[model samples]
Target chain A: MSEHIRIVLVNTTHPGNIGGVARAMKNMGLSDLCLVSPKLFPHPDADARASGATDVLESAQVVASIDEALADCELVFGTSARERHIPWPLVDPRELAAIAAPLKGKAKVAIMFGREDRGLTNEELQRCHHHVHIPAVESFSSLNIAAAVQVISYELRMAELADQAGEKPQWGTQWDIELAEQRELELMFEHLERTLVKIDFLDPDNPRQLMPRLRRLLQRAVPDKVEVNVLRGILKAVERKMESAEKNGNDHV
Target chain B: MSEHIRIVLVNTTHPGNIGGVARAMKNMGLSDLCLVSPKLFPHPDADARASGATDVLESAQVVASIDEALADCELVFGTSARERHIPWPLVDPRELAAIAAPLKGKAKVAIMFGREDRGLTNEELQRCHHHVHIPAVESFSSLNIAAAVQVISYELRMAELADQAGEKPQWGTQWDIELAEQRELELMFEHLERTLVKIDFLDPDNPRQLMPRLRRLLQRAVPDKVEVNVLRGILKAVERKMESAEKNGNDHV
Candidate 1:
């Protein structure tokens, strides 16, 4: 489960914060560290701050943007201390852990922390599916980026321990979400669209944006692997029925 | 409840960690910070790391020994990462929080963190009523002292919030061991051993060290309050029965 947890830091200005985050991740059994546009890298301060957890820094992925960091993550949460009037789904850190920690078995979970001073940009916040805040005295709520990472990492570790200790929030679906990785979902969608074209339900030349609309629908639906498999089965059965009908008509002619 | 909670760092070596502890404690609404014989203090690194939480440091109490640090704390818990061969009541951090957080209303609860290099020594751990361990990969389990404090503080805050949020929050329940305090258990053992001797079950001089064996057995048993009360009751009954048998010699008189 820890292997599937990724800690993403965006536009961090301090090198020591990167190290601090690595140390925190290792403490919490999290190994994946992703940095988006960090100002400093391979700096001595980071390694020094990492303590013995320098391996986390050494193996961390430095990406050009947030998208690259979160491409594989199905559940992405951004940390924000500001009370935005923008009306987003807001959760505190513990609540975030309760929802996100269990998903580690199902998909890659990314927890993104923004810059030291300003926090996550509104544009960056929009990319995350949920926002998490650390409860504090609002006047001195300026949690250091590393401290924020440490707080989230601590919750993640504690949540995992709780689940292991038998308080499992049952993921009892037959089409368990764990079976549907993002790449697998993409492949299943492609297969469905191709079958629709073969049966002329979707005319490749005169397709009035039907496939695109279907894509959007599927994206919103977020089907699990078993559901995706069931949809593909129906598409295959339609293609077989259409071919058999055409063959019988030719024989009669 | 937060006011009654104290975060203690024992024999700390790094100034930055002192600041880090303050920052993490303030993040979770915990303000009481106690440092026991720290190698350094009033360092710039700590102030820098504390960010806006300088108030926590300024008001921090510096003590000379662990005893002074925990003088007023009714419930004291020591955090350790290493697996110990000597048997002691062990609990995970969440369980520790669930049991200890509710006690803040009843008593001063202190969560003590050991040094960065060796963790709490055997003698130091003996002072704690219960031992808490944070789950981590055993290979690189050297969690910084500050990180340990942060993790426990996070759990403490979460558990308190859970109780206030109408979650019917459990106080460890199945995981909780309602053991008798050290002194109470000691008195019970003395009474039991004396009863055994009076009943001629255990000899006074050639007792062959049976009392020590009973002590080890009870330690491993970790009896809850009901079990402890039951054992004491049986011992008292045995002593009463022995006295009645002695009185039966009234026929000879």
Candidate 2:
């Protein structure tokens, strides 16, 4: 159950925090750690903080970008410390656990924690199917990066245990269709944006939050690979229709 | 509800751990903290590690003993990393929160964490009415004390929020009778043990697991103040009867 899920830390500033995250993940039975553009790694501070979980740190995959970290993941969750204006499907850690638990062996899940100072950027958050916020006290809401990971990882373990004990209802829908991977979703988003521009429904120059809103809508639906392909095919057909109208000098319609 | 609960760390080795625990507690909306004979307190390491929770560290109580830390608490939960031979009422962190959350405002609760090297001693474990064990992976079960605290405190906050949202059933049984406080339970145990020895039922020199077994039984019942009083009354009555029989030269009978 733990093997299918990965912890992704993006632009982490502190090496010690990376070590702490490794320890937290290992403690919660999770071993897959991916560091995306971490400021420091393979540092002594991280090794010291990792304690007995140096193996996790040693085996961690350090990637240059969030896209590379999450490209192959079927499900992605972005951790947010503060609320964003974008109305994405925001869930607490426990809720995320419930949603993610039954996906074990069926999907590759990636949970992303951002930098020490600023959390995941709006652009990074858009890549996630859901945003997870740890329910910390609002006044002193910011938790240590490792502590936040610990809380989420702990919930995942608890949910996994509950699932193993047959206490939790199977949350995953019995979809014979394979879910679209992150890279597939990215491609579909590109196609969507291009089609929206060609249809004159979206102003490419002044695209404020339209793309993000659309992303949220599509991400919430969690389209399968075939669904994504179908959506792209439709976008291509719309482009073809627009091109024919332009060639016939009837683009006004 | 969070106010009524205090986190107690027993003989923690590192000052940094103390700070980390404070941050974890504050993040989870818990303020009360009591450290029982930590190796170092008010150290720079602790303050550095506390992040923004310096207030919690500053206001933390430095007690002399676990008994002192738990003296006023109506309920005590000791975190154990390994299983003990004693058949006590053991619960996972979520289960502990389910049982502890409803006691908010009604009871003062103490959750104890032990040293970094070794967890709560058997003698210290006996002091707790119940034991909480985080379900970490058995092979690498030991968690950083702060991570452990974070997991437990997170559950507590989750349970409290769940209770507030009316999603959880009222778990606290409406007891008109006040529950036995830690000191009251301790006194009752002393009286029971003395009475047993007086009645030749328990030998003080070779008292193996008798007291711990009895403690487990009584702790599981979670007797109220009146119940503890009644039990002490019975022990007193038996002692009085034995004294009179001894005075009348019929001690054997």
Candidate 3:
């Protein structure tokens, strides 16, 4: 069950932090680790910090980019430190475990931890379907990278343990339809955006908050595979009608 | 509220781990820190690990024994990595938070972490009202001291946040708008059905399960009033686009 969960560290500066993360992940029963452009790896400091969990570090995957790290992941969660002006779907670590645990057998979940200093970039965060924020003190909000990993890993273990003990809280009725993966949702959004622009509903020049607002709303909905197909069908229909109208010289659009 | 909660480290061997614990506590809004006969105090390694949370270390109270460390506390929880032969009240970190957070203002709580090599002794365990275990992987159960502190501190913060929310909120900030009312939802559904039919995505003659499936998805989202309005506005835009397409007599629909 733990194998399906991947912990990705992005541009980690401190080798020791990477090692600490490995130990934390091993302690919580997780094994998959992906490093994206880490400043230092396989360093003595990291090995020393990893302690007995050196095996985790030894088996860690090193990749050049976040896209490469998350290529096959079905669900992607980015850890965010600051609140953005435009709201995004946000969940606490416990809530995150609740949402991710039930999909253990069906999905590959990736939790991304940013650099030790500044954390994930705005562009990097936009790639995620949801943002996870550790409810730390606002005054001293930034937690050590390894410490952040520990807290999240701990939550996941607790949730998994509860499941083993037959105490898992059922989150909504068992999902009848398979949930849409990251790539599938991305394609549907692209199609939807094209249709909205063609229909003159969305000004391509000044899209502003329209796309983000819609993303937040739909992401919160967490559409299933079938639902994504349905939404795409609507977009296709709109596109066909708009193309036909343009061919007929309707000009109003 | 956080000041009432104290974190105690007993016979800590590494000054670096002590500093790590301080940063973890400060990140979680905890301040009171007591050290029970730690091997080193005011070490450079400790300050370095504490990051910007050196204030937590500077103000830390160092004592000679557990009795002195937990002196005026009303409740004490000892972190135990190993299971004891004799059964005692054992609570996981989440359960610990649930039990302790309510005692704010009424009781001073002290949570103790034992040595890095071996957790609290049986005698020390007896001092605690309850034994708090982190529930790590049983095979590699021993977590780094600072990591353990981080997990426990995070749960405490989560519980306190939930408390301040009055009800167990979905964590983070509260929703800004009221949820869509039943009447508003029904109206939006009607509008949505009309748009789907006009776009030829949903056949009015034989809608089958399309409307029901979409309803289930959106209902699961539990959108707020503003979200409902945004959705309705999208539907209106789609309808207007379709109306123009139809009026142009280019209706391949």
Candidate 4:
């Protein structure tokens, strides 16, 4: 997971911030640092600010454009302080890390931060899959780029650490208490929809909004295999009971 | 609430950030600006960055030490991007607003940001009751000081707006559905302690530090009034059951 995580900085103005960025990344066990069109590289001020993270600076990869920096990356995330007028898939930093986790071995993930003065332009942000905003205090929402990087890196590191320990997840798979996998969850939803149709709970002709709401509710519960089985068992029992009652009534009549 | 907030900059070097700080504070409807031993002030760069917020600059309070800047403030919060050995009460910028909300009318609150290069020293951070770390990307966590101020101020403004809007709060106000006030929770805790003593679950002479542990547990829970009341009711029911059981046993004997 760590190996696939790439930190990309675009149009960085201050070499000191670049150096500080390197230090922040190194502290969090991430090494794939890429710079795009930095205004000043190898400045003395940046070297001074980098402290002991000189190795990160020395090994940094410089690219001319953001597209070039992220061309080979499977997932790209952009950090922005303000909401853009255009709509895009939005994820918090933690959620972004979770998305990145599964794709760790399969593809490289790039997290991009923009310049100090202007930040990532709308055109630049459009290249990324989603935008992650570090929710800040309403009174003061301007975050230093390096600080933003630290927060994102911390979330990534924590997510990676949690993945490594193989600890029983609060909502995911466990040996003794196995939860349904994503595929199973999807299948169950399909079965649920059919059952709802049979019971006339879902109007087959106009099942527009109900499915989304039900999906969200089920998603929140994150039903495990045991819970799902229990629910299905109850539904089956009810069906059998109704069938038995119908047979008895018909015989009596 | 606005009157009680003190925007503190510690060991600030650039005069521009000071002016920008003033500008950011004013933009967010905050005016209390405190500078702790700045390297330069009243510079042309600062005035230029301040824009029309010269009033905030002119009235800005200059202090020799952080202690002086925060002396009158009852609740102190420090901003840091890096983690330290000793853990203080860490809060995100949003969480800091919740912590500050209750003290709004009662006490002065100081939000301290450190030097641009080194950030805040651990010694300076000790004075803070809560340490707020802005979430950032791991690669470039170096946020500019003024930008940091802007973000923090924005959070405070949003929180205050929410408070004014009469929305159900997650952490502010005693009656908010999300969480009860700390004082009320503390009182409920005392009630639980008394009930425990009555039931002989707690020793009068030697409680063996149980109450402190219980307090810590409740603190961690951050129980709302509903949760607190539910727990209180359970305690009362248990006490009643225990009493009845003791009476029945005595009669049998």
Candidate 5:
């Protein structure tokens, strides 16, 4: 259970927070730590703040992109503090632990903590299986990044200690159905957007939120591999129809 | 149940933690806050950290000591991260909320959090009827003060939301024996102090906190109107006995 959990920090600016997060992870008896394009690491501030938990800092894997950080993780969760214009499939920390707990022996679980101020970019967020929110005072919900790690780490420890893998809600992500990987999903999304543009249904210049909304809806739906292929097939058909229409119009000209 | 719960932080040194606590408190819809001897209140750090929870901080009752913080509270629970030598009746966060849930409307409940480094003092620990521990990783269990508040507040909110108080562990107050006003309680405290002085049992000049200790004891009991009247009657009798003894001493002199 300990080794299966991957705690990822994305684009973290503060070296102290990286150290703080390492300390938090070690406290919870978790070892695997990953960083994606962090601005400062291997710095004295991180070493100083890590205090006695320098081992975690030394072994942390620093990656160039989120995809690389989360490539092998079967179940990925991102911590989201603020609600977007469109909602994603969100769970509180406790529920997330319950969901992740069951995947202990079966899957590698990665929990992502975003940057201090801007949080995870929309592209990074859509890569996650679930968006976990630590409930806070709504009006003033400015939770520190490392502190967020602490709370989630605490929950993960509790769930692991409780060994509640069997009771997690059935999210339909069972053994029979394979989930579409982020790369494939991103390709499908690009195809869908292009098809929408070619059909004149979506304005590229004034594309307010057509793609992100679709992404959100599809992300929540968490389409399986088969479903992703079905969606891609539908988009290809629409693209061909537009191509044929354009050719007939050219003939008219 | 929400109205009955008061979140108290004692001797908090960091304004950011205070703001964080305020935000956490607001997230759980538990607004009643009492700060005992905070080092740096009205600081911008707290306001900045509080995000939008300034109202919770603004309406927060800033008190001089834990006694005044719990002055009107009928049930008090202090959070302790580690085990103490003297075992107080302890409950995890959820159980504490369950115990406090039933006391709603009948008694005001206060949950105390100590300073970051040295949790609640033994003397402060003694003031509470029960001790609450938020289960955490023991190796690195130094949870930031606000996060601890967030976890407990979350539990309190869940218990309240389960809405068990309305049906379970009935406190029998059901609109009977109106609680004495805080003003009346203060007046009673004054009278009791004056009478104790007249009896030569207490020295006003060298007061060793006899009145405050008594106030702490009585506040936790949260006596209702009838009980208050009975205590007042007893105090009046003691006052009369002191007067008669003084008169006899005068005659003998």
Candidate 6:
């Protein structure tokens, strides 16, 4: 997972920010750093900002463009502070990590951060598969570029840790535990509706609202197979008891 | 909860950061913005930086001192990127939110951020009940004040939403089923200690370290009344069994 996360800084202006990015990545146990046309490299300020993580700087790959940096990457996420007019799959840092986790071995994952001043232009953002917004305060949303990198790296690190711990990764289809398969649940619902109609519990002509409410109740309960069986059994028992009583009355009469 | 947050900015240099701070607070559904002796205010640069959060800036309160800003706040948390010499009661942003949630009606909760150049002094930090450090990349730990505010505010907003939805908070003294009252637990611990000495399981002369460890284990367990009573009963039974055994042995001898 660590090998898969390639952090791409696109057109970073300050050497210090680049250094800081390296430091941030190292803190979260991410090492792969790619720089796209940084204004300055190996600057003393960057070294100062990097603290003890100069090794990350020493080993960082400086490239000419985002395309060059992420050429071989299968999944690329662009970090943007502003909402672009163009429609792209938008995700938060957390969601981005979830998307990256399963694609670990299959794809080379690259997180592209834009320039500090204007951020990723729409054209640059369009190059990536998804746009990741850090969910900043609406009033003052300008996050330092390095800070953004740190945040994204943190999410990636957490996701990697969760993967290592064998904990189910959140925010993916994998974690969505429905009561039953959709088709099965739908069939069960239909059966319940028909039973309700037969038992005169539901007004068949105007059962719109009642059926939806019942569905909601069942969904909230998230009945397992046994629970569903128990409910069906109860309904059957009631129906049988009523039928028996009716038959006995008819015979007596 | 939104109404309860007193967003205190201490010795802020950049008016743009101040504006961004206001914007961040507003984004998180927090409206209270207090500035302590900022270098610039009402600057166009701030207005420009504020983006759409000018409402927050317009309504922001400017104060002379951090103390004056946080004077009414019952719970004060100073946000620090740098680790201090003396460790304060440190909390993650999530934990800070937990503490802040209950204090909504009790007292105002202030989150303080210091100057961009030089962070809050030790004296200022000491005034805070707790310190919140955003987990960042260790190499480049520097986070812009506005970004820091955004993260903190996001946590607060999420916590408030969870609270409204009746979700349990993540920290504080939870109501444990096995937990006895402090006095009762202390008494029980003393009795257990005495019993241990009687049985020669604990040495009377050097029981300090062992007793503390036992106490810590019990504390961690947070035993309830039933569990405490059950433990006492077991201890009593053991003592009775020991006495009977000693008496039987004496008779046999």
Which model scores highest in DockQ? 3
Ranking by DockQ: 3, 2, 1, 5, 6, 4
For residues A102-219, what per-residue lDDT tens digits would candidate 1 score against the true structure? 7656668788999998998976775555677776656667777777777777777768877786554424333323434545555666787686565445567886645433443343
Instruction: Report per-prediction Cα RMSD to one decimal.
Output: 26.2, 28.4, 3.5, 17.3, 30.5, 19.4
Interface Cα RMSD of candidate 5: 37.8
Per-residue lDDT of candidate 1, residues B1-253 (tens digit): 3788898888889899899889878877899999999999988989988877899999999999998999888988888787776878888778888888878668998888988888889898989888888786677677766677777777787787777775431221122235578877888888877766554556688877566655643554454554566557545644453344444433334
Candidate 5: stretches off by over 4 Å: A13-20, A42-54, A81-86, A164-253, B1-3, B13-16, B38-48, B51-64, B101-104, B160-253
Please give the distance, in angstroms, between residue B149's alpha carbon in candidate 4 and its true position after superposition.
5.8
Q: Which ten contiguous residues of candidate 1 chain A have the minimum total lDDT?
A: A170-179
lDDT of 5 at A180: 62
The digit string of per-residue lDDT tens for model 5 on A203-233 reads 7999875565556545555455666665575
TM of chain B vs. native, candidate 4: 0.66
Docking class of 4: incorrect
TM-score ranking, high to low: 3, 2, 1, 5, 6, 4
Give DockQ for candidates 1 onward, in order.
Answer: 0.09, 0.13, 0.50, 0.03, 0.06, 0.05
Off by over 4 Å in 6: A1-4, A9-64, A80-90, A99-107, A114-130, A136-147, A157-253, B13-29, B39-58, B81-87, B101-107, B115-118, B137-142, B160-164, B167-253
lDDT of 4 by residue, B1-253 (tens): 3777999999899897787677667766788999988899878868876766788899998899875786566567778787665333467666777667555665577899999888899767655656787655445565667766765675676677667765443234454334444445556767877866664456789976455434432443345456656555545554554455445555555
Better-scoring candidate (TM-score), 1 or 3: 3
Which stretches of model 4 miss by more than 4 angstroms? Answer: A1-3, A23-30, A79-86, A92-107, A115-123, A133-144, A147-253, B1-4, B13-31, B44-59, B65-68, B78-97, B101-107, B113-253
* Winner of 4 and 5 under TM-score: 5
Q: Quick one: best lDDT, which candidate?
A: 3
Please, what are the lDDT tens digits per residue for candidate 3 over residues A1-253?
Answer: 3888999999999999999999999999999999999898889999999998999999999999987888677788999999876656788998889878867777788999998888999778877778999988888899999999998888888888777765432345566777787778888888888877876778988987777767767777777789999888878887776677666654543
By TM-score, how accurate is candidate 1? 0.67
User: Over 4 Å off in model 3, which ranges?
Assistant: A126-129, A167-171, A250-253, B65-67, B71-75, B85-89, B98-109, B121-130, B159-165, B168-172, B176-178, B239-253
Estimate, for each residue in B1-253, the C-alpha lDDT of model 3 and write its tens digit: 4778999999999999999999999999999999999998989999999999999999999999999988799999999888798999999998999999889889999999999988889999999999999898889998999999999888888889887775543424455667789999999999999887776788888889999988987887777788889888788887787667667654443
Instruction: Kindly report which residue stretches of model 2 are placed more than 4 angstroms away from their true locations once superposed.
Output: A166-173, A248-253, B166-253
- Give per-residue CA lDDT, model 6, range B154-176, as digits (tens): 67866676687664521354433
TM-score of 2: 0.80
Clashing pairs in 1: none
Whole-model lDDT for model 3 versus the true structure?
0.86
